[model samples]
Target: MLTRWRWFIAVAAACALPSAAQACSCERPSGDLHTQLRTARENAVAIYRARVTAVDPAAFDGKAAVEVLEVFKGPVKPGERLDLPSGGRGACTIAFKAGKEYLMYAQGKDATSVSLCSRTHSVTPGTESELAWLRTGKLPPLPVALQREAVSCEPCDIDLVGGRLIVAPDESPSSWLWPPQAAEAMKEGRPFFTRAHVDSEHSLIVGMSFDGKPFELTQTHEYAAPSACTRRIHLRWCKRLDVTTPAGSPHPVFKCIEPGESSLQCDESKGRESSWRPPESIPADACLWRTSDTALCTLEPRMRLLPAGARASPVLKCRPQDLDRRDRNHFCQVETKPGPTDKAP
Candidate 1:
């Protein structure tokens, strides 16, 4: 009865796919290692530890004969040799070598097909935990303490602040990504060592870490800002007011502040005098980035922050607005309040 239910689930998942083209595109396998094992066990028609006795290499398709050592699922008796569909040129192809052992997950009763995408892999010490769970149905316990090894990411040409790349991709020095393991270390903020690249005028970022993992960055005009709204200008007044500071100094900066009500309007001067208009109500969920203290704010939810040594432009861009109303207002309030510089001291 349990076998029948598992078979039904596999069939249902296949049927639910939109088209045959998406048949192999499984939803990202979720859960921890143990949970994933349970899923694979329930989904597979045959799960066994097998020794590849023979392999027939042919054009387009390959076949292998395996002698079952242990049967986790299916009715195949131990020592029974079965011919399995083994390899192909496609993305799902898995290679099987004669005389080597593997933990195999095969589908179909009469003619089994094994894929690289399945839990099948050569027997190794790394798979001991998974194999133990499959045989005993016990989840592995977490270690009391995890020891982290520092990843030596040698300095690239790019300037870094607080272990973060301080230069933008456009103006960054030659930068490279660490290897998969080393990259994981970098993401976890582990210390890595590498030689720094000489500062160059090149603005494009492209390279790989000493471990040979390629890091690619595409340069664009758009700035990637954080989710926090660092600055906000309130346009609460009904009429546009242009109060120039110090009378005139080429271009005077003006700001309109109103109490309580949140108005998204009041056309202010950006850099030079251009035009003025009444405000409009900004959407409740608007993500806006300020071009400058006095310039109009733009919607840039995915904008990146300005890195060190970035080319100075006339209009300065601020962070995007927060999603939560309270958080947005709280952050905006701090920014709007006068600082020590504004005081008499």
Candidate 2:
């Protein structure tokens, strides 16, 4: 009887084991590349191209520091350092190696993180379309049927389908204020003039610092659709105070005013005064001095945060037994290296 019971237990255990093929299968993701891009953008708080600059091999978690290469879809500027906290050896881990370029789609606005399940992957061939759209503010075409069906509706101030042909949602907002250093100089009464242009209800305010820093300012209103419609509606309202520059030259040149001076003369040729107002929500006395507030002021209007309820499904899940399984089923082994098909056109 004891022998019979042992045979029965062995058979039950064998039946419970998953077939090798079943353990490795993954359901293909839906949507084309553009759709995936839209989904990724909607799900990520930040996205950018960067190179891993340093890694902490001794840390308990896989931690790394990366330098920003391009400002694709984050509140980060080029040259900023991003600290990543979760990587290496988990179902959702991204094994970041030093000296590699990656197109990272990160989550969390404050403490940023990424995973293999994310749209984040190593930069490779055929990926040019996405980056091109980022640099040039161009939108790729969608399927004809989906295009024709999605028209601008009342609830959707901007229709996603029809809007893509006209608006480049990924474009960054034109800077409307000089950098802090330059602004500080102007506040101290520096004598300088700038040529300016206004377009699509937006204007570019340029200036130079006493130390030769260039100030490029842009002020524009952004609009977005409430739902899947790509057409955008007004996201925020911006304002600028009227002020004219000190006299001289044919073009409008903004000049810094003395501490007590309320106004300055403009050049007979042409002069205008422009003062970029902080967002209504920000405190008036705040200044840019080694803090994230500066980036928030710059990238918030421009950085596309994940929308209300979008999800990116993971391709793999590591079970308890799969933890140290360094073989095919191990989650950490699934690396997305750029292949020939990944090249940009």
Candidate 3:
């Protein structure tokens, strides 16, 4: 999930366009409010709050002329008249009605086209938040249904000491710690290491630590058995392990057991245990793991390092709205007013 968020943030930051479509399929806009705003600001050639002053009646190639009421971006000025593409039966083509107001995200320098794929839509109560954000450059508060009590896990501390990563484990319910013998071996600097579980679809590997830190590893390759293996049934089987390291680290060293065995190996060792470090290259504001699966720390909305533990309350299930939209497989945080027991210690 964190991997998905990282990828989402990168794509949202770049404001990359969706692939060209031959049919009526639109990429879903991000559920993140800020991401949506950033994408529109960066990707659209022109944007405006305007009223459709006139519309051509042609069935396939009709155009709508809008009178710009307010310009949020581009060279267009208030009250300027611009003809934009409208009324088409094909996929992603939009139809505009005269005399209606709209928030237009227009393509091209001439601002002559509007696509359903963009956020262009009729102005209504539904768009008030977006309009407010554009006008004030501040994200409006999430709707009541979208707001939720901030959830936190039990506290754990992760640090990098002497080029080696160390996690100070706590008694949190969600803590992922090595057994006592392994912990002792790690302290003694013995040759013990944990294997990372790979999620090939996401191209991610999650490595565990004796303490509680989880390393999210990226960039991986898989090798298969050679043609010689086809001649021998037993030789057809290849030993392979996907090894991953923190993004921006040096290329990982392959430490195969036998000659030609496929595996990932790292050089840095602390005591007898192998440990991976947090991404030193990432900004402090970026998310970092606090436990194997429970919580993350971020510096931006104030430095917050939640501990790893069971959730404070049963998961709150509710309908998706605004920024609270979540994929079907996941449950989003639902609105909950803070109670006295919810106060920070």
Candidate 4:
């Protein structure tokens, strides 16, 4: 009787497992690459190589999946090759260069680039454009560690997918203005900047000594993504109210404000002002994980957390056992090196 009961329990537990294949939806957990593709295909995601037969901005509502006909374009000339991401149902069309390969994703409400797999092989010129591409090169192993570097006591998450590295979500605010050094500079009646002396938004706050020379920094903060975990951020430094230079330009002399980037000019003609604002919803001098604020994570169907320091730190905040497991049934192994596709000729 005991044996019979044991057998019954085993059978019930086995049946509880979810299907190996499922659609890419919110309910689904972020999964391995094979699973992502399977579900994406079901959602009508496909790759294509066609000419610019026509265009419809409103097709997928703002997320049009354009089609570039094979007729012609610069590098990707007629009969050559090209790539595009699509909804596969013809509901939307994303734009691609006259003739080139592009990886597309189903960006959410706003317009954003879909996550493309750098590890997957490049799509053939004529395949569907919306289809996700995979990276073909070798990849490092899953992070072996995670750690905390910030003082607020907030921790960062990191993730490894199909051998790709990712940082976790960021919810910190810039309200922690005036790190230690910035505070001291103010008290000394010296000319000091709020951030690190690196840039005006310098992670290091800077202050002037009695002789108007540079001295001690109150704090050091690395600029990162604001909210999403994909976009990298840009930083700047300033010696005066409106005059700011790139992180590493001559500043001690401070004769004239020389803006390095053409896009960023101290154009007194445009009115001298430098209260830096993020291109998107980001704050100055903070870390960001995502590439574009309007962009979405396309590599996986669901979101995954990338713990801080998992790439190299000795400690990890997220428990190791807490790390989940997926079936080996799909996707190639995370490779630090690769074996040939076929045995020796």
Candidate 5:
């Protein structure tokens, strides 16, 4: 149930990874370069084919992002969280509230409430018709225990194993998911929040609101039970990504998303640190960024490739293709067509 800003422009280009996070089951301090490879071989991740039934406008915030729904996986309810392998806000948000919705808009430097989704679909970054959503469906399927309760918090605990760190909410935040769970008897299909109370230790569950916090509870030791055996949950982090895990340690996890196509190809760039080639699924004119060193990439928009040896070297050394197409004479123009939507004008 994560969200972020999106570009509406229609150009053919790839985005550079802004930063990264570690979401893989095989996250470790030493890390494994062959982890994704091995995971794919064992079908650790499933690649599903989906088309853009619809898309809402996108907005950018300095922090996280949010988007609307056009087409989606399963019947997305209100407030349900949705994400693609590329790692950005979703097109089909779980609606502000079931049927209620909002538009993505930039609030100065942060991507915050700008407007609500129009009664009639409005113009947006990508063509609503051609927008294709890419994400892992039920990557870690939820346990049946969570589906039974309408208001519940699936445990979001992290544990380290096999030289890697594995972090997942008990059943994946059953009560407070952005797009909400796919289907269940009791489901609070809305974005979850962190509600804190100083005076009263009591916390109330509520729907998503830009102005009001979601589920705020005092940070006191409410469930102070004696430690049952000491279990350590090791984590990894890309200090560069600007993201911190609740757990003391941090890690980097990347998701490759390509719009309107199958098979995400995240090829490591020949000469760059944590950089790679944009797969064939994203758009040419899409705005994307990696908030952490452990982020992801989504390629799309009719293959705006390197025109048969356009230029071998990168202008910005692993930056957005639009900005780093080291073709010199055409460098500035590279990022011209499909730069980030929030890119400073």
Candidate 6:
């Protein structure tokens, strides 16, 4: 009876075991090569092309010494030697071999590691597209169906599709307001405005000039991302506002205004400007219109602006996930007309 009980217990224990152990799984990177590269660059602490100099043989304790050949992103310089983790004895870790060059997307507390789950891979024919981008910063061309076409409009030429305004990098005066590198890219005709997600109800307005009397252009300022805590004393939050400058010009078009404190003061009267009045709505046909108290507007009656609810197009059905996953404030999906072969009988 005891022997029979022991046999039964062993059988029960064996039955309790899982049919198969779970293996490592990784979520595939979304979007095209351009998007993948952008995502990797934003997430990884350091990115570079490097050749492995040495590697640890121990499967559990994998490590590699690599000589940096090129610094694509981050503070690491070329010719710098770095010790990075070789994806160990698991399916998720990268297998780093000595003498092999790799485009590594390194991420960790110190940015000294690689994983098979990342875009990191050996430099080969398979990785030529990535290498080309790293070397010359050229992006892969869009599909023929999704290619952007120029749309002529007043003030600036834009691509208005599905009610979203696609501004050319060169046409944006704000692009010239950026640092020298961005200004140079604008000059080179490389795309600066990759993506935007403007609301269908709203219109994007850029570059307006008065025909008659010369009116003083308002001196506008662009602010940097505000710090969590601006100051240590009152913990007053503040943002750094930089004066807008013209293309290739060092001098600011407007006088630099002193940075102001946040409206967290005890006196409410001081926070509100008494001279400020509610903005009056201007006619749609006028050279300019008041969309809001703080937004710029332009006249585009020829485009025949559609109502918000009627803005949906059958050709362009963008999913919520696609819109949510995008890393931009404004986004516009391309519309594709049905091909001759796609038509039903």
Q: Sort all candidates by lDDT, best to worst.
A: 3, 1, 6, 2, 4, 5
Q: Model 2: which ten-residue window has the lowest total lDDT?
A: 288-297
* Residue-level lDDT tens digits of model 4 in 1-345: 001111111221122211111212222223333334444434423322344333243212223234533321123333433223422112222223333343333333211323222111223432232231223322212212222111111222211110011112342222212334444444555444333322111122233333344332321111212221122122223243232332332222121123222122111113211121111111111111111111111122122334432343221121111111221111111212222122211
Which residues of candidate 6, in runs, are more than 4 Å off? Answer: 1-22, 142-345
3 or 6, greater by lDDT: 3
Name model 5 segments beyond 4 Å from true. Answer: 1-157, 160-282, 289-297, 300-305, 312-345
lDDT of 2 by residue, 232-287 (tens): 22221112212443232222234222223122111111221112211122122111
How much lDDT does candidate 2 score?
A: 0.36
State the lDDT of candidate 1 residue by residue for 290-310, as single tens digits.
Answer: 111111133322323334444
Report the number of the highest-TM-score candidate.
3
Worst 10 residues of 6 by lDDT: 219-228
Q: In angstroms, give how far residue 341 of model 6 lies from its true place.
A: 16
Score residue 221 of candidate 3 by CA lDDT: 16
Identify the candidate with maximal lDDT. Answer: 3
Better of 2 and 3 by TM-score: 3
Deviating ranges (above 4 Å) for candidate 1: 1-27, 108-111, 142-345
Error of 1 at 30 (Å): 1.1
Model 3 residue 36 CA deviation (Å) reads: 1.3
Q: Candidate 6 residues 1-345, lDDT tens each?
A: 001101111222122211111233444444433555666778787888999999886433468999999888887989999887763333345558899998888776655767655657678764665667677888533222111111111111122211121233344333212233433433454433211111111111111111111111111111110111111111111131122554433522222133234222122123221121111222232211000011112212223323334422212111111111221111113233311222111
Score residue 231 of candidate 3 by CA lDDT: 12
Once model 4 is optimally superposed onto the true structure by TM-score, how far is the C-alpha of residue 204 displaced, in angstroms?
8.1
Question: Model 3, which residues run further than 4 Å from truth?
Answer: 1-22, 29-31, 143-345
